[model samples]
Target: MVLIGICKYSGGGMQLTKNPNSTDGLLDISYIKDLTLLTILNNIQSLFNGKITSHKLISTYKTSTLKINVLDNNKSYIQADGELIGSGDFLVSILPKAINFIIP
Candidate 1:
């Protein structure tokens, strides 16, 4: 079975939510801004145990929608499913249980 859902497409990379049941009608957005290898290693256990938000440097949110816009011209881009779809500004919305999946 392929569990498909919206993920935060950030400069670092794509990431999945800490929990994947998707019952709250909201998306669990997680990210580590200004991240480094050291921080990841330090919190390696937490990350592996599904407690990434335990780190002070990490930020998490549960929202039905997210909006972001880049003020600088650093050639940033928004990607989906491994491809760059747009750049500069982007909006993400969740449809709750609307997205059906085949658990094969």
Candidate 2:
């Protein structure tokens, strides 16, 4: 499934909570903002090292939106839509299951 929004843990690297909207389950993506853009690029690249062919980033104006583009080995792509609300400190609220399909 496509996990959207920011998942926050109580301690260190804990399982993601089901209710990301809750006050306690929020994480800030801005913390990593200080990292170089190249580092971020490499980090994202590592996510689909070999399992997928390519990926496309989607742009959205909505603060509560999580847009994802799924790509396959055939060089085709598909888009998945979801909502994510920022709860301050870079935390966002995303749906539990928003995966659409892999493009091919």
Candidate 3:
């Protein structure tokens, strides 16, 4: 199953988009500039325990894309897509230079 845009909720709760390509790859740290990577990861972990499954890291010369696949027993496979937003040191340090996500 391919998850697309964030789900629509009329009341509360956060809406997370399933689409892998919906993101522009912009970290947009402007909102939480002070948040550390550990903090972010911890927060994300707490959101849904056992719900999140695999995370695919795709890197290019100057950009990295994270494809998060959520596991669902009712579904066959999960998929998402993202593109490069900017040049970063992480991308430059990774091997292979160019990367793409492929699920089989």
> Tens-digit lDDT track for model 1 on 1-104?
01124433222443435555445677677666777788777776665455666567666667778777678647666666668676776678886678675544
lDDT for predicted candidate 3 compared with the true structure:
0.30
lDDT: worst 10-residue window of model 1: 1-10
- Each candidate's number of clashing pairs is 0, 1, 7
The residue-by-residue lDDT of candidate 3 on 1-104, one tens digit each, is 22233122211332232223313432211012244577548666532432222222211111233343335444333232344343222211223324353434
Residue 27 displacement in candidate 2 (angstroms): 8.6
Candidate 2 lDDT over 1-104, as tens digits, reads: 23333433322333222333333333222112133566546655434342111223321122344433434424322222322432212224434345443334
**Which regions of candidate 2 are displaced past 4 Å?**
1-3, 10-62, 73-104
Residue runs of model 1 more than 4 Å from their true location after superposition? 1-20, 101-104
Model 1 lDDT, full chain set: 0.59
Best by TM-score: 1
Lowest lDDT 10-residue stretch of candidate 3? 53-62
Can you give the TM-score per candidate against the true fold? 0.63, 0.20, 0.21
Q: How close is candidate 3 to the true structure, as a TM-score?
A: 0.21
Question: What local distance difference test score does each model get?
Answer: 0.59, 0.32, 0.30
